[model samples]
Target: MNKRKIIDRTLLTDLAKDVGLNASHLEALGESCQWEIGVDGDMLERLVEIQHQFERLAVMGDDEYRGFYIEVPRPAPEEWGDAEELIASGEYDSREAFLADWLAFNPMETRWFHVASNRYGDSRSIRVTDRKHTHFIITNHSKCTDAEPDDTWCRENLTRLFDYLQRMIDVIVANPDGFNDYVAHNLPYQQRTGRIAQKEFNRIVPNCKIEVEDKETAIKALEDSVHGRSVPPLETMTIRQYCSYYRIANEAYEAYYRKRGASGRFYEDPQDVPEELRDVAYYKRIKFVDEEILYDIDSPEDFIRFATDHYGELGLSRLNIFASNKRQKGWMIIVSNSYSANVGLAIEVATALYKARAPLLIYDAEKLLRILLEEDYVRLVPDSYHNYMGYQEEGSVYELPWEYECSEDTDSVLNKEQYQAIISNAEWQPEEQAKPIA
Candidate 1:
């Protein structure tokens, strides 16, 4: 309705066509005239084209321009003589400086359109996150700001946002014990694990009293009490192996302790630990494997196998390992002999495809490769990247192969290309998976 509202390219282009004016002409006119634009006579026709182009350009995706970008240079005074006189002039060398001053003086005209239109299209994206919680938050730089608001205003807003986030983080940190207690009470699985662990622990460490604040000390005491009594020394069990034994001990304790007075092969009357310990269950289930294992594992089957094998020696049935590190989306796994090198490569790849927001997928490739090269699982030594077994190629753009067999359906799996496409075009609505090729 208003000629002044025609800011983006789509509306402008359409208006241009309707009024026998081209996009180039309207843009030229906009650059040449500071007069308040109004819908009248021939100008109305140009107004329509301007509005059309504005709408079209507003929705264009980021990658639609690829390598092409427009660099608008300031026009000489003689070229836009009339328009230049209408607007204030200053001793500014750069057009950006002039624009800054121009915007300071005129708020309404300055914030007309945040995005620009070019041959390829507009450059803006809308991002939503459910899968990429920590991943997105961590990757986000303080630099990026919204288009509609100026950078200084956006910075002020972000400062307030960050202050709020900091307060939230502080709140979470200050109440870890309470949070753990809540989880134990509210979460069924956590309650089960806690009860079982406490029962089993009591058998090994008789009259054990667990204070929430002394979790680490309690764990150490349990290990010390169990070593040379029911199980091997603290040194004998790797962290992973200890986790396996602890969980089995818990379950076994639960089985034996609930029916108190019953004799058990592992320990007698398994209620040696206080029942209060069961109120904070999550801490009792200590995992030996580093959080990194989540990135290395492929199928749920692989996770299960890893869990079973680690605990099997301790006569444990199955261990539950939560993959806390590897989240569901915005990340993909890459196996490499050198974790450091691969991490660097991942970052490079991420930057090359920044629009995609691909997170570095870490695996136990470094450890495994060292083991493979050494021909001994127990003894490993750091070696050069090329010396590792996973190093198949030496090129800059080398395609790293998966060490383990991946699922056949690649469509569901997040890859570089797919990630790039998604980030490059936020408006893209991926088609539902057609039936996989026969």
Candidate 2:
């Protein structure tokens, strides 16, 4: 039997990291893309209506088109029990009679109707349903043109729709923990394993409506096994506790591996590995496990040699360079991502601002851009304070891009006078402006 390897969640996270995109954002993008390709269940119905309208216009004002005319019909509201009784009692034998009675007391616009045709020398008809009740222009039409709708227009509309959906998905993914808590108990029996934990189980199944009143009893029955007080000496506790213990054991194993220093790189033979850390295909399975990165490189002597050869002095220099250019000066503060020194590029760029004498005010660039600017030796301050604590009051301190979070901090700074000057002196040059994407 061929055993399929499961990639753990860590590996997936690592893959996301490697691609420089968040999983939530990726999911949003994927959904949006799928929607663009017409994964919607109702899309075919919509397309059918559109095509039917074209068919209805083919042959008009002919005797054969008598029953093909559009008819507006309405059904009684569900709240009308009396109407339901009459409808069941056959008080109104035909649809028209029922509709006439329906319209007498409660009048409403009919949004859907059918346009059919029998002039094709055979019976041909179409039923059109309006998805949106937009105002329709009734007019005479020539033959149905075979030309398709504009591709660019369709693409633009689809793109806009997808983008809106993606934004909503991003917001949802960012707060997974909160959403999970809301669905914990009411989930169905079949979907119990769908969630990461009980809290998450409750969240996604919020409307499942299953009662879970005696949760404590189940927990107590499994408690003896969880705390290792069960009767079976060899059997151990319940599955949930077993999972908890497995998590703890993995943590301990990782801690142990990390404590062994660079020498520990040689501990795991390339051919042999702990079961938990064996898989490399999964991000969770291989991340920080050390064995994957340093596996098979031979003894400590060989491992040390490899490290020195590949990442020793140059790596140290890179680390030093990263550390030195990391911190960015906010108007009244300094900030840096302590774990990763990705701001080195920004420091270099910020240095240019300093050289240009673009004011000591913070340039609201991204961390990297700020670091690049700082390489130019620009002095920026946090808006909250004056002077780097020297207590000098500056008039109307502007927030720089460094302080503001943006995927790319490229927004240029302009004083009130400068902005006014541009507005006053600017000329209309439509030709020079780039046309927006449709």
Candidate 3:
């Protein structure tokens, strides 16, 4: 698969880069994004919604209309037939009819005969120019007519066109991370990150995994195995011969090694046995069971999707979700095949399942984002002054280990002016003047 490329852009930054147009036009031009999606398609889709605005500037309801610059080439003097003869001959009609005939009767001269529309005279043609200046208006109807250099053209018509362009730029650019974020929202409860150390076995499985976090646990586990701390050797085990040697009941065997087999869930209650002794065996293993593990997961998002899709029905219904950055590659390991029902799913998996059944309520998006992204500013005072020294002032300082332990209320972090500024900005966000995007 090809690596995903993330393209991030803001339209205002982009509008500045469109160097072809002058400041007059580009100054008011809004921004847009079209992340691999065609810009033309996006623009056209939005323009259809605001066609009603075009009528606001019309002199009369435009029927036969035009709105683009065209070369007004003078017809050759030779082709300019006698106006008197053409008029009296009953060939010429009104001013509009005469204008149409003038263009048709004239032969090609290759002057600045600009024609933006291929189907000009009688048909409808709409266009939106980029980086090039092309603005014209001609119409037989009164409602759609827009005469240049007039208030109607300035206020009603031009504003509407710029307004339409702004809407197209507001769409955010799509990226690969967006897909990951999307998957996170839709992820099923069963596919979150999990740990393998949380299982329980009810039977005597020959060999299984033992959980170890750091060097301390590993070292202790190692010491237990070498010193035979888990179980007494058969020779040292007095249970078998206890009936002969001690005159005690034969139940001595079961009593001495009570729950030693652990019914196989050794991790749950080793029954005072060392953790390294996950099973009756002396070997330290990292697996929960002896069977072959088959669930293969790649990315965190893929893990969620696959696990949720095949939860419980697969041989192994649980998965271990390891956190890794990009460059990792997908499989869902189910837990059913773990050979025992006592093996448990990781806490994250359980949390995910719980969330699936009862999702969290998001009352405020801004507050949630702030909480997620905010960093704590810890005030570590020097050891010399101690707790009570700096807190002489009313609300300037927060003493540690006492006020913190007591759960005392904190004073406002912002000063009066700072608070006022922040409050004003918050209140003004929606009221700020923005070029209309409709």
Candidate 4:
């Protein structure tokens, strides 16, 4: 057997530099020692030389590599005919028809053109007008065999060709403490890094309750529940199943509030509540109490008394306490000129009365004034104080007939003279004719 020539130390130093290794260490091992080293001892040295050869192949000129490689021949320039020529030759009827036929024959070549055009510059205007000719040009210029193509060779060798040099450099540069770990991880066929030991791997990737083969079925069931497509049976509960149940329950809570109007109060014990009625039941209980109190009041006096006792001072400003006679019904509300009416209180009281099965006929002070003026139910009294405060005196104020009453009583009646006098002198004008209410 012909013995392999011993690599000189100078050449070894240059190889070390090319592969990003410390050249000083190779240089320290002089020419005499390089020849003395045994075959087994010089295994790393031989690997460095192979790495250098691969690097040389990677950086070879494109034209030089293409000349050496056998490629598929290109079509003649005349083969790329325009739309008119294609139609005249009976190859295609229209530009679209020709393009479809060409694309079908050279799909890979069209893709390569897009990839190359995109990599080099703007490719928005570039299009496959002649796919057969384009395919031939791309294949003929490619520095790879007809079976492989340039992209295929680049994809295979781009990372792999540098892997040996990178691994060598990693070992040489690694800290002394982590040298063994570096070798086990960076060397061939050792891609997985974490939990190398079988025991550790088993601990991290625990077996599920369902078999591995049945995981897909279980996942689909869980997804169905999450998306509200279908609810899985409660008996077959898993982690994913429980998550779906929680989501469904939470959605039911939101829908309940949306349907019955938000009360701003969430259920106190969500865990104890049933999934279907978790949101509605809590609000229903609260509303039932409010309805019971409001329904028991048979007259406006009772309503005023209830508001006074339960809400005290804070409710007094909100309440426009009114009373209607037992017959010829007409409401007499006590209002203050100083206090501005609360719109929210009117809405809340109206909602409660509606829930108590009462007909809604309530109006604010401004609406009451408008109805009186429009209907001519009462005339203003010129002799009386035009801006009399409603809360100041019992009956020294504006007046209207039984039609203005929002209650069941019908015993009250106002004389025509009093009604006309009140309407004529009262300063409670329509908004367009009056200043802002004080």
TM-scores of the candidates are: 0.15, 0.16, 0.14, 0.15
- Candidate 1 similarity to native, TM-score: 0.15
* Winner by TM-score between candidate 4 and candidate 1: 1
Please give the range of 10 consecutive residues that has the lowest summed lDDT in model 3.
195-204
What lDDT would candidate 3 get against the real structure?
Answer: 0.25
Q: Which digits, one per residue and each the tens of the lDDT, describe model 1 over residues 121-213?
A: 322221211111110111111132322223343233223322322322232234434423433332211001111122232233232312222
In terms of TM-score, which candidate is strongest?
Answer: 2
Winner by lDDT between candidate 3 and candidate 2: 2
Instruction: Rank candidates, TM-score, best first.
Output: 2, 1, 4, 3
Off by over 4 Å in 1: 1-438
lDDT of 3 by residue, 1-438 (tens): 223333222232233223212222321221211101111233333333333323222221245222221112233332345655676787875545665676564433221111121123433233333212222322221233222224332333334444533332221122324423433343221112211111111011112222212324333323332342332222221111211111111122123234344232222223565443323211112222221132222233333333233222211222222211122121111111111111112212222322222111111212212212221111222121222212321111111121112222345333344333322222111111112122
Candidate 4 lDDT score at position 133: 18
lDDT-best of 3 and 4: 4
TM value for model 4: 0.15
